[model samples]
Target: MATITVFGATGYAGGHITDEALRRGHEVIAVNRSGSAAAREGVTPVAGSIGDDALVRDLAARSDVLVVAVHGSADGQPYLAALVPNLLKAAAEGGARIGVVGGAGSLKVREGGPRLIDTAGFPEAARTESASHAKVLDALRAADTGADWFYVSPAAEFGAWVPGERTGTYRLGDNVLVTDEHGKSFISGADYAIAFVDEIDEPAHHRARFTVAY
Candidate 1:
């Protein structure tokens, strides 16, 4: 099993991913701001600040994969601008791959159409965060690094509010959003974790971005 180090491991997406990785027999280093993330077998919870490039590089040096599940915006500021570069540098230096938990807003609503965040009627409050994440994806695509990386954008209805069951089934998509026959796009946290961990277990979409949905 791979040794996975997950930042923001106490948050919604990160928490599920950490548990799923452990369930799959992988060693997990769960990093959080508080350093008090709940204990679990096969997990070593540590407190860390994402802004610390040294800490990030140290962790990357020890991990087979570095998973970033934190938000793009922090305290009303775009955090990924600086953080992404640091991660790229660390991955390049430490011989570790990178996996980012991105938002659905980056995915196009339809092929050849505008992104969901750019679509009319999209929530204004979420625009900034979505834009930040979109920029991260852009940066990842443009970067030249030795380490492999992948970005995962969840479905439109994803999050804690609609935490669906771990059905162990989901669809994967490219730059476009994925939706069911009924025109609903969604995936539960557990199922999303399944996809995330699956990617770690078997690499796919290397140096690219993919989306998950029901």
Candidate 2:
């Protein structure tokens, strides 16, 4: 029954997380530029920018967990790279753990293997965002704040184009990529939401990165 604050509540991952959390009877603060109402009921909406350190600190201080699914690379903003430091500051001030939504580009296919983004077949449309997200993860790993934070990377076949059904099952992985017998990795949005909230309740993989896939 933790109070969770989602920084990009209108987006795909954040919206799904908000839905799953509310379904589980947790308090949700959905933050977005518009502060728009969540499509579902039982959500408290907050309209603001993550760059506001004071506001973010106040929110983080009040909540038990802060879910960061905000990224602006595609729109040419790169806000996540700039927001990580302030988020670290806010989390440190408020004692809230951060649950970061990560990109698959950072996941290693094998020990000492090249990252997915560095691989030849990566999409050009994803290259900028992937690099930006990688930078955010790097900052989170190197930050001196000592705040509890963890990154959650999705699978290779994740995204709207790959909409999958709720299998009610998923596999968790470390920094390495998780794949099926056919080497295909995927997870539905609803299932990913379940996995994300599960971490908030269980608090496993603290201060580290863990991923999910089918």
Candidate 3:
């Protein structure tokens, strides 16, 4: 099993990813700004900010997969802009693959039109951070490092999703949003975890962004 390190292990998405990674028998090193919570049996909690280059590099050096799940605003701060690049550099130095938890705001709505964040009904508060997420995606695309990277965007209906039964079934999409026959886009947190773990097991859609939906 691959040794995986999740950068934002305390957050909702990151926590779910950590749980799923452990369930699949992968060694997980969970990193949070304030360190990790009570020790889990198989997960190692690493304490440090994503801006700590030395710590990040050390963690990356020890892992096979570096999962970037950090949440921050586009406030013109160094942390916001430097997070992805720092992780990429560390991953390259460590010879590991990178997996980014991307934002749905950047996902294409039409073939060549604006993204969902540009459309009406998008929350103003979320737009600020969503833009940061977009920048992370752009940076990953432009990165010339030979290290493999994958961007995974959750359905537009993400956040506070109730856990559904893990039927081990979900649809995957590329760039475009994934909606069900009812014309609704949603995926339970549990199912999203399943998809992320599956991707970890079988490396598909490398160096590209993909989404999951029920």
Q: Which candidate is the best by TM-score?
A: 1
Candidate 1 stretches greater than 4 Å from native: none
Candidate 2 Cα errors over 4 Å, as ranges: 39-41, 72-74
Q: Write the per-residue lDDT of candidate 3 for residues 62-107, one digit (tens) a residue.
A: 9999887787563543245557777788888998888887788998
Question: Model 3 clash pairs?
Answer: none
Q: Write the per-residue lDDT of candidate 1 for residues 98-161, one digit (tens) a residue.
A: 9999999989999999989988998898888888888889888888778799999999998999
Pairs that clash in candidate 2: none
What TM-score would each prediction reach against the true structure?
0.98, 0.95, 0.92
Best first by TM-score, ranked: 1, 2, 3
- TM-score-wise, the better of 1 and 2 is 1
User: Which ten-residue region of model 2 has the weakest summed lDDT?
Assistant: 70-79
Q: In candidate 2, what are the lDDT values of residues 143-186, reduced to their tens digit?
A: 88868998999998877788788777999999888999999988
- Clashes per candidate (backbone, < 3 Å): 0, 0, 0
Q: RMSD, model 3, all Cα superposed?
A: 1.9
| True lDDT of residue 6, candidate 3 | 89
Residue 44 error for model 1, in Å?
A: 0.6
Q: TM-score of model 2 relative to the true fold?
A: 0.95
How far is 47's C-alpha from truth in model 1 (Å)?
0.7
